[model samples]
Target: MESNLKWLRSCDLLIQNAYVFESALCRFVQKDVAVKDGLIVDVDKALALDSQKTLDGSGKYLIPGLVDIHMHIESSMTWPGAFYKQALRWGTTTLVADPHEIANVAGLEGIHEMISNALSLDIFFGIPSSVPSTREDLETTGGILDEGEVSELLKDPHMRCLGEVMNFNDLKQEDSKTRRLIQLCKQMRPDFLIEGHCPKLTGQDLSIYLAAGVDADHTHQTPASILEKAAKGMFLEIQDKSVTLENVQTLVTHALYDHFCFVTDDCMADKLYAKGHLNEVVKKAMAYGMPQTQAIYCATYTPARRMHLDDRGMIAPGKKADLVLLRDIASWQIEAVFKDGKPIASYPIPEASFSLSLYHSIHLDPLTEEIFQLHGYQGKAVQANVMVIEPHSTFTHRVIESIPIINGQIAYEKVGLNLVMVFERYGKNGQHAFGFVRNALQSSAALATSWAHDHHNLMVMGNDAKKMCKIANQVIACQGGYGIVDDHGQAMVHLPVGGIISDGPLAVTASELEEVTRRMRQAGYVHDHPIMSFATLSLPVSPELKITDAGLIDCRRQQIIPCIERVLTDEDND
Candidate 1:
């Protein structure tokens, strides 16, 4: 390392008298910070000599660039180059991401591409701990990352943490693959972070999860439960849906600011551009009565410490100069962004390119309108189990509804019912399952996506079978992406490689995703986001009833249940 005293003060960038976030001070203080060769060399009156460049921080809050300890770049529907550059302007400097979306589709090859792209920027990865998430009976994924893949990835310096272990239900079971993956991680890097995806787990279940070496959770939980998890020594990675005013109040009153961090675990591209990335989390926490410094701390240092990344979370000497300058701290408006001691500028990032296998991910047989038809037995009416959509939540409610059969088929003309189906798009078994959905996609609308959470299977639902088929075919045509059909006509955003994300510019992708949202709203859907609607439908880790390519799964029991119930024959009734 070069000696700080040997360098002239006029060497590089100088930021003076800004409200710098001081970890040791536990608050902001007016201090001059100097950077050389992309690392902070000195602070507290370091810029007394002439400087080559200077940015006065008058009326500005100089902060260490926000670090998102947990997120999925694919959730933004953009590649690392685009997501990193787009989020930087919003004050996010470093990202710890999970590449399981691609891992599900392409296994080690996918993980390698994600790592290579992220290595070009301040992006680090948690090795995808659960590829294919669950067993093959519940869902089908194109790829599987076993012990061999995990061992290979652990050698890469960028692989800092083990990805979210979505197999929460299997931890207590002796022969679970999740346990093997966790044990492998422990054997490799005993200090590596193991992230979690357990939502609504409490008491003994929570204890079991923690005992399995889970160090963090990014799932939905109540304020009380959040406190309990943190108290039990598991770091909380709070997302937007769980960040109500009530929860924030509980956290602020206790001031366990160091125990938790703000993370946008799954932010879409359009929402990322409109609201902001993790900066939005900082703003919301402030609104919930968190002090500015504390909120900033949660967004910055807390997460970095969780990942054990000591190189770039602060502005002290020897830390990488990842800085975000804010015009106003209250609104969290970013004035400028600098990474590696250089300013970031707004420009369209080119689309990412990949190998032929990534491009040829779709392995589905051609689907038609007839494939969406719901067949009925020899009964006038039968009771059916339906997957109920609870707005703004990844969890679904399982409800029983009586269905009146007409002409030996389930009625498509029902007032509040929509046809939901999942196709094993990965070419694993070439299987498909049909189910019923209630209280979503109302009528005259359909949406299909290969970006279905965990499995990356083909998930589509709608009132119109023809339209649903059209959307599914569109996804097949592109190999992966989102397709929507409403009264306003049809629109598509082709994500070709794995259907989870695109190589396209984020600006272009965000605009197209925004258009899809607008069309979804116009068609009378009331979900907070349509992409969330598409992604969560197949994620079995979500609570209650969720659909998989195999069928509707009762997530709590971790077993497949019938979407439609059979009616007793007259002979049996007698």
Candidate 2:
């Protein structure tokens, strides 16, 4: 006790008698931690430390603050400040975000705006590797981030790694732009990580993609893909959707914890509020049979190591005092959170500022019912290609259906189909395309949003043309947001920043999203996440079929296909 006086006198804060999760050993041991100047000075058993502040962590579990290596702040729909505040409450002290959603709308300016708004040291960014997400002819975006933009962003200190390389198809070709971006990242920052987004890629294709220098992937994974990717020296970032029993058991049984970490790729406002952030993922992983120590390690140490953030992620000497005190390790209940040795409860809510131009991003002429009409051959019926939404998945299947023509317009309702349309809102071109969707909105209502994935274009769907036109115009009127016109009446949640982010607080956004979700479900939108499912309809790179301003896309073929395959005559109808 006498010898400990010198160290105790210099300690700024001391947490005594807690089960400290030693990440290096992947186990917990009772220890007292000493902190000074926001860095851990000592961690040992029964240290008689006296300090300015000391907390009796007698029954708590002391774990490293959670780290989310891959996520999207814009997907929360609020500004960066709001997201930071909410995340910290859930004990997530570190985050690596991919701002590609905003980049697609505002380009480099949008990326700069987000970086400026991030006033905290804990939040880092990845250079958006695929701002357009696909070829120009496949879809229209408000902005593009090509080689020049990639080169410029790599210079920023906050830019940790290249964001998820979403253009997997392009990476196969040597001269493709995606491959060039990978080469550029390697040349500029060879040690930096390169994230990936190759869903369902397997065998030789997956091997070829990894050969292109992508270090990690955070897409949905099957059991086989998980093992294969891990075996091939690729890092796995398991998000909420991939936290299944089979996936978690595979990791535990095979002892594959070292090669993988957890991430939250695109959590919506409501989900983040009600369910939690990376902490929730940790909980689910535990529930799915992952040991507590392994789960915590993956959420903290592994993610930090993956991002090359060596300063934090563990309770060790000289490490940043980013820690979480939990009342129960089994339930993962966080009692207190600290950042840099300071209690996060005392930290003020962060504020963010945006440019005036971000609020006025929508640049389309007024939409009308006439534009929603699909003009076809003046015949009795027409054979049209329809996009069928698969249940519980983003992949859509193409099917041909014969629809009756009324007044030179395809009567989609006659065959139980909904009209889906995409319009270029960038003011670059007044391009528009029409298609038919199965298992979308079943009521005589319309829903429109400028939050279309990777494009930020105006996408509308409904059974009634006039209602579709009304909602589409309403979304444009608000600059960018979700607009719904159903039996309950019009509802919206404005996202004025880059037409992909909300300018309001997280609570307001979450509440509005809840209301909008309730209305959408009432209007017969069948999806677990109505907003995300509807928004991603225009993401051309997602799967078998999708729609964009260019037209209906056969994603596998990577080309635009016509809406009307052929006009059916009387003989064909018979």
Candidate 3:
């Protein structure tokens, strides 16, 4: 809040000037704006002034600073600080972030890091609710949080609401733990907000979910879904990844814009740089035929209203000064960005070089010997059920089938590997659980993430029992990170950021991830980086299928089902 009078005196500042748009029916341009005490003191036709800094608004527009309703900073593949620097440069002055990835793996420590990062910048934190996403005991997580933890999180100054509560089916079933956590948040903050994750929920199930006090949803797959949720008073978050310009066109044409707001639930660093942030969403919406004012409203007022951020969604007196100055409305080019009435970003961009320092693992040690023991199998072939997940969607697909059981052990199948096993890394017990899956991890090598979906667990995916055990140990040895090893027992790549992020620059991490993905492809794996895919697979709240340490999960049934038939096969012994 330092004063900038050196640049404000001697005819230094311009008078009132603004390019105004309202209600999709009116547009006006004026030249009169005065800055003092870091707030727009006045805006009118003219003001007699001796200013030191004067900016010409010959033909430009002034709008409120953009707000991103929902986003995951972990998806940026960069640390929080680095993401903030780059994001601010693009006019994202305020962001609502869900640190579910870190919370899953590192538990409260992860959430603490998120809070610290948010405090360090102009941002808000939405505490994650579903950790160890599913109640699967077969997996080992970084940590766990019950009602007590949620209560503590809610007390934070930055805590806005309980993050996306993924276990909707469990909520429907009246699960005690789930209910208690939600109730705890309510007690902590009477009008507490809870985000939703019911992708295909409808009819009675949807009603029950809405009744639980969940206020918003980012998983709307269709206009019908948005309409259904809106009918129940849920704020629909329009996603950039799932809802593109083509589909946005349909929503705008249908005039279903009021109940919706824009959010980039997961935009990678590369895409954020190329396409822009909240501003991009606004521009795309306009190009798709959404009225410019409507687009601006969706990007600003609507989300601010939903979040209850009453202090700064408009450009009037008494409102916190957060504004975006644009060169034009058509191209949506940002000219300058301001926060609290002081220009924070302008032309002549600085070189973008970001770095992360990770102290190598010193407290953890690698297992030089085999740590897993298997039982209940006999020969070379066996039957098993599998789990599958679609791309860019929250729900998973569970399938049951028969496959090869090699050497008295279940083999990792490439074309249709149905079941995969998970071992707890923190426990010497080496408890092994299996589940059915499809559409990812086309390789036999194990893929682990401390960044597992809802609950950060030591999630390992591989068909080979021996390699799965080995990779799990390696991940544990690194204390946390992602590791992929070949079917022939060869190490491919390792990025040990609490088993979640890479302690390197975004470009470096992206390059290493590219190499790991390349190796997966070379190893006969057909899917993309199965590493990032596993993060969502453990989320019990999404839908269809997922696995925790418990075993193969039937999310709808809210219980773990066996992946194999009762009969034992010869291959189970390997």
Candidate 4:
């Protein structure tokens, strides 16, 4: 093969005789790659160049480093430094993180903290579009990112795109604040991407949302939705939950590889440590009959292109030398990872520093057992609106049932219901509300967590009022984290960082999370991911029914509905 002598001499590293993924063509071919000054200078067959370093890549697969287009660093319950360390081990060399979790807690200051701490990693920040994830009337949040905040955040160079527009209901309004925010992103950064979070939206609602300039969606997807959205020029980000055989088959059958990508929207610490990162998503797609080359393209090139990060998604000249070496393509075993032509082993893991305020975010008065009691019922039997947790999903179904009342307190246990409470822990109004969840805990136990989604309020659930109070107080005493109590004993995982993230190593956080999951299962809290599912219970923007410090929310209508539908008289009860 012909070679440039001067360029070859300047080459810093080379991998000879490997199956290189040519992302532009979405296929693998036998070739050699030459890196110089942290960028690929040449990729051809049998480049006879003697340079500084060379590795024999015979029988190995070389692909561009994986790029995760959408994720939350805080979702891992650890800081950016810890999350990146674990992600790097699995060949994820780049990340596009939505710091909305922390932004909802501390606004722009929180986002800035995450950006400063993540300088060592190739992480791009998205300006959190929905800091509260809903209107202030619907729920209470520690921080609010208004128009001024969004405009100010857009000035920062690190702010790449507007984070997931979670407030889909508000987007329907012609003059809503969310619409203005979308306009502002277009005005300020015309080229920046606008992400979406419209779960289960269809027909005119989906059309109206897309018309507002929002282009991508990472919500739970189905085969029909995939075809519909892709046909409408919308980019689909398939997360773990959306990686089913039917969905993968839809993409493969329709040959819609370029219109979609793989992302890890909200992975827990235990899952990241135990399973894997974006690699797991890639593996699942391949297992579901997606072509191996296409799966790799979706994880790398499509994602990078979706985010307009064209510099490092392919093994081509003039691109950043971010690459991954796979020893076994079938199993997705990564042998080594390179960033800027240097092996990851040469770089040290970065550490983060948090302020005192972040460590003490949870602020609320003490709680008593009476707080868990439902009051103001004047009838012996009352018809109450209950939030029913659908099996194996975050979406809850609303059900109305009649239950007996004793001394003005509803007998939730009589109707096979468990008490769920949300406390305003930001010390704003000391507001608290009570609701009931059906098909939750089977045994007599309580679980309290300050990691309640979006709002980050304190939420406790149990059939036993005293145990609920005990667990809630424990979580408050520690200022953050999860508290579980059952007949056996009690356990807690202290997440002191903003009351949502642990200020410890990733392994320690993962181990603690595993223990918490084990204990939750023992208490009969059945879910695929207990902690995350429980935390999202309070996210009002999700769907159907949810609870906040204000009251129970009918998410479809975007209004607070009374937990008790109506009081049943003696005749009605009979």
lDDT of 2 by residue, 426-539 (tens): 888889898888988888889899988879899999988889999898888888898789866888888888888886778888988888888888988888677888888898
- Supply the TM-score for candidate 3: 0.81
What TM-score does candidate 2 reach? 0.97
Q: For residues 104-164, could you state the per-residue lDDT of candidate 3 as single tens digits? A: 5556776786666556566787888777565545344555777777778888878777888
Stretches off by above 4 angstroms in model 4 are 1-7
Query: Which 10-residue window in model 1 sums to the lowest lDDT?
Result: 565-574
The alpha-carbon deviation from the true structure for residue 161 of candidate 3, after best TM-score superposition, in angstroms, is 1.7
Candidate 2, residue 427: lDDT: 86
List pairs with backbone clashes in candidate 4: none
Against the unseen true structure, what C-alpha lDDT does each candidate score? 0.83, 0.87, 0.64, 0.88
On residues 116-189, what C-alpha lDDT tens digit does candidate 1 reach at each position?
A: 77666778898998877777788888888988899999988898889998887777887777888888888988
Worst ten in a row by lDDT for model 2: 1-10
For model 1 the TM-score comes to 0.96
391-444, model 4: which lDDT tens digit per residue?
678989988888899988788977778888999988888888878898788888
Error of 3 at 157 (Å): 2.4
Reference-based TM-score of each model: 0.96, 0.97, 0.81, 0.97
Is candidate 1 or 2 superior in TM-score? 2
Residue 552 in model 3: lDDT: 64
